[model samples]
Target: MNYPFEKVADGAEETKLIAEEFAEELNGGDLVLFHGNLGSGKTFFVRSVCSALGIDGVTSPTFSLVNEYHGEKKVFHIDLYRIEKADEFENIGLYDYLSDEDAVKFVEWAELFPEQLKDYDFLITIEYIDDNKRKIKIERK
Candidate 1:
């Protein structure tokens, strides 16, 4: 509910709650960057937010690179996990997705191309605390 929000989720339910609450603050044209290690729930958090936005069947775009969805709002889900070079960004038409002013864009592994992303609405970091617990932090900029 606030910028620089921080919480330690005891399990998946709590994390989903946090994602739903975070989704409330989102709007069209917003860009959200997710930072977390492998198996740290980044995709799950994105899925939760999309679910709160009236979208279903959300899944990771890791292999596909980008997945677009339409619900209450247009959503662009991108995963740069397998991208090896900055040039690959352009090759994947990532610029086109980023230029969509009427969509909410969520980027996973955004930390991999920091220089390519200069403007973002929210930056979220999820750190695994255990098999079931995670520390989630969100910052608005």
Candidate 2:
């Protein structure tokens, strides 16, 4: 519930609780960048936040590049995992989604293009500690 919050989630349920608390501080037009490796629960964290915001059936946007959801507020979920070039990023019209003023945007693997993602409200890093535990850090700018 605080800026620069850090926690170690022992399992999915604990992660969900943390995400719920984090969601409480969110607002429409906020940009949240997620930094983590593969299978590090980046998408799961976003899903949990979406759920707390009254959205359901949240899934990774790996293939589609982005997913939109309507809840208490509009939500834009984006994944940069499959994108390997700046041109590809531009071709997908991601800039438009990033600039949406009526939606809360969550971008996974944002570290992939730090230069392009200069402005963000929150930066969350999820670290895989083991099969059941993850270290989550959230920083507000």
Candidate 3:
């Protein structure tokens, strides 16, 4: 479906539906780069993906930079808010995870490494409108 993004309605349930649809089509080795401002529903969508994958207790990796979850497959969710060096990420072995047969990845604040984006399978941008509405666009590189 070309990683098509759909506008999400207000509230968490609607967001879950969107994420579930995305998860239904994705598999291991797929990397999703997320671009969105704070409170733009980035983490919410990630959490919903986790839920769809049968993962429990999904939490933001705001401090840890990366969170690993084991559901249908391993999910590596990385947040680059604290990263000052994009090269340092390579040293952290993020690429290894993405290449792993049992792992999938989702990255937030990925704009820090524009050059590295070509490795991602899809790109996503989320913009907050009013109240709880969000405009999301997903594009293939």
TM-score of 1: 0.98
Which residue pairs show backbone clashes in model 1? none
Top candidate when judged by lDDT against the true structure: 2
Instruction: Rank by TM-score, highest first.
Output: 1, 2, 3
Candidate lDDT scores, in order, read: 0.95, 0.95, 0.81
Off by over 4 Å in 2: none
Which run of 10 residues does model 3 get worst, by summed lDDT?
Answer: 1-10
Question: Which lDDT value does model 1 have at 12?
Answer: 97
Tens-digit lDDT track for model 2 on 1-141? 776899999999999999999999998999999999999999999999999999999999999999999999999999999999978877899999999999999999999999999999999999999999999999998
lDDT by residue (tens digit), candidate 3, 10-39: 766776787887888787878889998988
Distance from true position, residue 106, model 1, in Å? 0.4
Kindly report which residue pairs in candidate 3 clash with one another. none
